[model samples]
Target: MSGEFNLIEKYFVDQQAQRSDVVLAAGDDCALVSAPVGSLIAISTDTLVAGTHFLASANPRWVAHKALASNISDLAAMGATPAWVSFALTMPEIDEIWLAPFCEGFFALADQYGLQLIGGDTTKGPLSLTLTVQGLVPQGEALLRSGAQVGDGIYVTGLLGDSQAGLDVILDKSNATKPFASELEKRHYLSTPRTQVGEALRGIASAAIDISDGVISDLGHILKRSGVGAQVEVEQLPLSQPLLEFVGSSPQAQQYALTSGEEYELCFTVPDSREDAMWQALQDIDCQITRIGTINDDDKLRLTLDGQDLAWQLSGYDHFKTN
Candidate 1:
């Protein structure tokens, strides 16, 4: 075994070797698990590559937090409670300082959500991290994109476009030492996956998805899967005060709000009749839910800006596009 693999096996894998619920764990070709009867399994995987998902010189702690949080967002989209996660990290070299802070941030967030790090793999390669998260829900009760119907009210949690704003600052480099830089940087680094809000939406939302690929694009998934369309008011898009100040109400800013990725908020559809109740439920959980638009029978996605309907020149973030 290599030195890094030996380190992981000794410090991490061996420590988790005795968990009773871990049917199969480390030191194996593949991990296995036995799910309880009547419970459904939810699994999600996400990969973060240096210089793509994050900068090559990005803080290791935040990189680790984001790697785990992104997968947790998938669990939230299905209204599942996170149970366990396994990480696969590829790095050119093992830096103890980087690994320590990275693990600290990773474990802190995992512990906050009651998730256990069961097992993982480490290897020598370019810096990349992948996390596979498993969650559980009652059988047949998982929320799906196919549940949306016409006349369903569209709701989103928190504000949009802050992460994009943060990304701009990071890329510019000139803004790094500015006063608002810290706040903008936090938006990109410390994404809060809506796990609690998603759990609270179990019986309330008709359909749900996380806003990882920007609102218009992510909502397109629900529309396509549900075989419905929507009419959204651009003004109703919740923008953070910082984002407002940063972009200054420009048409360009509006486009970024619609297309920026990595916001990690929840966009869901609920019946109009359940609107009040859903709002109350969200409030009780201390989550902010904004009613942004409504699903429509017409098979067209429409956006209204200042009482005038306009065609979107673009949808949302596309991985292959230069954007």
Candidate 2:
């Protein structure tokens, strides 16, 4: 069995992404990063356990991708520019085949965002992955869940419920056929962070959050923090065609869109005054933005379908209540 130091040198050090802000990377007691002037550092951490987050039989490559993507998604929600990441891998044993592809996937996404792998650790334990990522945002401009206000328009970036459908396919619960099944699984494993769109929303969005838990659950955070309520139009949910086909009913698909977790899309609110400007700013970003609801002063979330009141009994992922 290869030792921890040996594995770090072979798989974690000297990654492809290089950042000028990273003064010292890997092989040190603590990594050093230079904070940009007039900028605030935003940091987030996520942990993926073998059975809790992904199947043990999952591909190492996608596992690495999901681990890194989840953490970066938090940074994106804060309207931050990704700059550095530190990873920690705990596994019962190391397989060279798994190590090679895992490193490949981790560095690939890091390089795409110009993230430097500053430091991390490899240890003997149950199979799990943890990552801490840091990003920079202009002082006083970081997006937060408490910034929302009554009468703001609620919007979501990209389609929802696809990741949950993908999970169903992975676990053999989906009846979806080929092409569609593959597409669903891809969306599950390879979630986009929406960093660019989040940055674009910095000044425009009144409040924002990344949808890791279902949209209802994550958006609830924004509402609770801002002391506001929301009226969501069920018919307006951004459900993808593949998800609709997989579930075989518009209503069922919307249910999944509302309650399924791990979507990683952004749910944001924009003041009525900034609505037009928000659209104009996000035009160049390669993401689909949909208006799905409105913030209100009632301090409760209300669901409606086709102008009729809709009752929602379902909830999103809760670490304690789920599984």
Best by lDDT: 2
lDDT by residue (tens digit), candidate 1, 223-243: 999999999888888877777
Local distance difference test values of all predictions, in order? 0.81, 0.87
Residue pairs clashing in model 1 are: none
Clashes (N, CA, C under 3 Å) per candidate: 0, 0
Q: Which ranges in model 1 have alpha carbons more than 4 Å from their true place?
A: 1-4, 14-32, 177-179, 250-252, 318-323
What tens-digit string does per-residue lDDT give for candidate 2 at 1-323? 12374655677777565578877786668888899789999999899998889877888889888888888899999999999888888888877878889889988999888788888888889988888999999998899999999999999989999998888787774345634888898889899998998899888898999999999999899999999999999999999999998888999899999987887889999999999899899999999999999999987889999889897698666532333
Candidate 2 deviant stretches above 4 angstroms: 1-5, 173-179, 318-323
How many steric clashes does model 1 contain? 0
